[model samples]
Target: MQKATGQDGGEAAVVGTDGTGPADASGLTGDGTGPLAGIVVADLSRVLAGPYCTMLLADLGATVIKVESPGGDDTRTWRPPVHGDMSTYFMSANRNKHSIALDMKDPEQLELVHRIVGEADVLVENFKPGGLAKYGLDADSVAERWPHLVHASITGFGTAAGAHLPGYDMLVQGVSGFMSLTGETDGPPQKGGVAMMDVMTGLHCAVAILAALREREGSGRGQHVELNLFMTALSGLVNQTSAYVAGGAVPRRMGNDHPSLFPYGPFACRDTDLIISVGNDRQFARLAEVLGMPELAQDEKFATMSARNENRDELRALMVGRLGERDAQQWQDELVEVGVPCAPILGVDEGIAYAEKLGLDPVADAGGVPTVRHPVDYSRTPARHVKAPPHLDEDREAVLAWLEGRGADCEG
Candidate 1:
């Protein structure tokens, strides 16, 4: 059923001739598996940051109702890697959820949203400062009405005196000093290869929500939890920032090399590169013996960790020279066998395969839709892949129908 969609966009829900969900829904699985099996999430955020967070919730068995704007989340059309007219960018973070489109500007739709918010156990929003208020869906106002709802907000900055500024992940990384510490210090500061700040913020938000839900067990009330990319980036640099604060040394980018450790980075082998972390003197000795250079461990310049750090350049050169006699994967296997923490640099595919071989379900079927597996695991109630990332408003009519039983007058 994959069709060619032009750059100009279209909505996600494919309405039947008589206006109901397809005779067979192509996307929605509704399997109800995993840890969050019975929870309901009202997702009112979009793009990577918000969508990623809500997607994590969806993966945990939450019935996530993705509230897209009438035009849909912008990434829905960010194509070139499109699948059946859906963008991979959209698919990357948005599996295991149902979509519902609404025009927030319309008063009737706003009323219906309030009804949905009322029934929601959790509500996640990433609207700009004061943007949701225009639609009467702000946290403070909504929480007042739904006392048990865990309302979570993802902002660029903390919602304080300075709330108007937009919160994009890259911008926060640039402004929060992450960019200054990335890449080479002498070279231009580079943004991370992926949207790491956003990823961290999403994870932080999920953690906060889970904590709030635990607290509500006794308190019998939900609290408003807020997370921003800036705060997440700052928190993620815990060790680095703590070192600077305590040691009075602002760390700069060292690239693949470890700043405080030697012989703990990528070294060129005969055919490839491998990373080896010699955590202690014992490990260093083991590594040296494995490389057939036992004398290097006793050498005055690299005897201790401090000495090795001081002579990092020389040690790296020696290690690389020895490593260059073997292939990266071969060195990896030997080092691992010898008890040194090591791995070869793997591309995405190789990484996935490696994870799979280790019995890690790196990928799983999202209701027959191929999707990456969820990161969380629970011993008691396992998360089930109930659904795949829904097409835009794929569940609109169905959701509306369900809402009818809730006794809320839906406006759409």
Candidate 2:
């Protein structure tokens, strides 16, 4: 529940919505309470996926050393959303980690990378299948050198023929059939507003890496873990994919509508858009009553789950007709009081504020930087913020000094 004050007292390693790092660290590196306190991560991933995965690891109290190119993370230049030239995109991840720039094209710099990778407990990357082989950082090569290092790699695709293809999140979103199901039924396919696959892949990769690390506890050896945006997107399809695979159904775009559930997506009210996610017949009865249409519960055409789904359009028309008489908020308040799951559509800022209003504490201060709170909550060893995202290679001197102290025999 404590905020990260950062190890250097410079900036709390946090993704700040305010576009600034927290500069005042409370002078604590945690008392080694986080489950990952002594763990170390060598993060070399760029853009959203890798950085986000590593940032989550860092939040869990890992000493993540962000290894960047001489140009630093490519996101550093994704601008317009900049905090004094420091890309907010970059700040979105890469917190609570040490950073050092090592140009692999240079032999000496590559050597430094090897040294760090050798010492790190975990290494994360998002290069193409054969991308890191030239620098001798491939999973096979690193495994030979450091048998105890957990090597996790993220790719757009697997190491098959598609390995060379770019792994842009939007591309995966479309290619993975998400776009086909998004947007209005009559509109062209549309991708999610955010980097959906990238973040999903990151989350998946983190879980895999954590599982691998746990397995290593017994084997006394590390392993190579891999994930890709394409596979991740497909897996994330969840019920949509299940419907197709299990029932031989091909889902089409149904804007603001659920495939097998009636009144389970967004609906327009008198004022604003609201979501009425009715799950079962009971909730349907509640909703029908709330709308002063108790007859809906008795109507055989809409009495059961299957009937309601089959007649969703008819149901929607009836529900909307009644809902349009009352504003979204008024309906939301009434429905919520009766245990119906519903909410007015929200902006990102409003969502955060709403979480705060509900005591979720969605925001946290990392040192002086304002950042989103960690998504997980550990009863004993919760995630902690300790340092702000590094200013490209800002920790070069310190990291090298620490390495030098570890001596030439740092990692066997």
Candidate 3:
């Protein structure tokens, strides 16, 4: 129930009570008070998606052992933004885990990995479909050896026809039709700023792993959970995909505008742009009142959600003129006061500052490194942040000692 302070002096979320505080020198993995306190995760994935999924498990108090190749994870070299000697990109998804470098092709190392998988509650890997078959780490192989282990595999595409295609976030974005729906209506397709498809696939993989674990409780047996980035991207498209599959409509790029809602995108104010979202007719009426144009809400063309959406061009023209009369912050304050959801577009730093101001601690300390906190808050069992991201082969001795039954303390 205690909170830590960020370097900026802002209070962070409650920690320590459930073993969710900073790491101790004792080499314990977590406080064993988190939901997944006793869970052991064998992380054989690299880069973003698989690492990201296992990181979530680690945050929830799982003892994650990251098995890396001799050169380590690809993200280790993905730098320009480094934290000391490590890549920030690598740190972003690797906190709270132990790392041991091993050549998967070596008989000794492969045997060690089998032992790790034997003791793991979950095994996550993102190799090409059937890539691990040679090493006996594939889902079927692992399931045969460890019937109680949840085996999750991630690929760029499915195991069937698209297995040959490498899965990268931008490739999935383009192939899944996400890029087609981004950017200005008249401009070429665009990819998102971040690796959205990889992130989404990781989230989906986490949910699937959890579900498989829950099912294991009743059956007392584990199963294979397979996910692909292409599918995840398609599902993540959500309403856009629904528009095509169910409504027989193909959605296209419209820049920042919402296809079905008026006043849902950014509008220019006197000094800056503000995003105004008027979800329903009541909110539209309130927005009109705040704009000193109450009659606009009564007009047949803008009276209802559907009507406003139908005549968004005219409504946008009117709203834009009224919004331009004042600065973005002034209009945002007034509109928000009237229950209309609105805000000035904020940069990433400003967004974090706003979250801190709202008492939602978005950052946490992992050992001495600052990383984004887990998104969820549990009343009884909080997420832990006891370890910092490890350097390549950083925890080899400890991990090997634990794996070999040497009584090494590896988990809180």
Clashes in model 3: which pairs? 156-167
Per-residue lDDT of 135-158 in model 1, one digit per residue for the tens? Answer: 767877876667777889988987
Model 1 global lDDT (CA atoms, 0 to 1): 0.76
lDDT value for model 2:
0.80
Which 10-residue window in model 1 sums to the lowest lDDT?
Answer: 2-11
> Regarding lDDT, does 1 or 2 come out ahead?
2
- Estimate, for each residue in 294-334, the C-alpha lDDT of model 3 and write its tens digit: 99889999999889989998988988888888999898888
TM-score of 1: 0.89
Sorted on TM-score, best first, the list reads 3, 2, 1
TM-scores for the candidates: 0.89, 0.91, 0.92
Off by over 4 Å in 2: 1-31, 409-412
What overall lDDT goes with each candidate model? 0.76, 0.80, 0.84
lDDT of 3 at 11: 32
Off by over 4 Å in 1: 1-29
Best by lDDT: 3
Cα RMSD of all models vs. native, in order, equals: 7.9, 6.8, 7.5
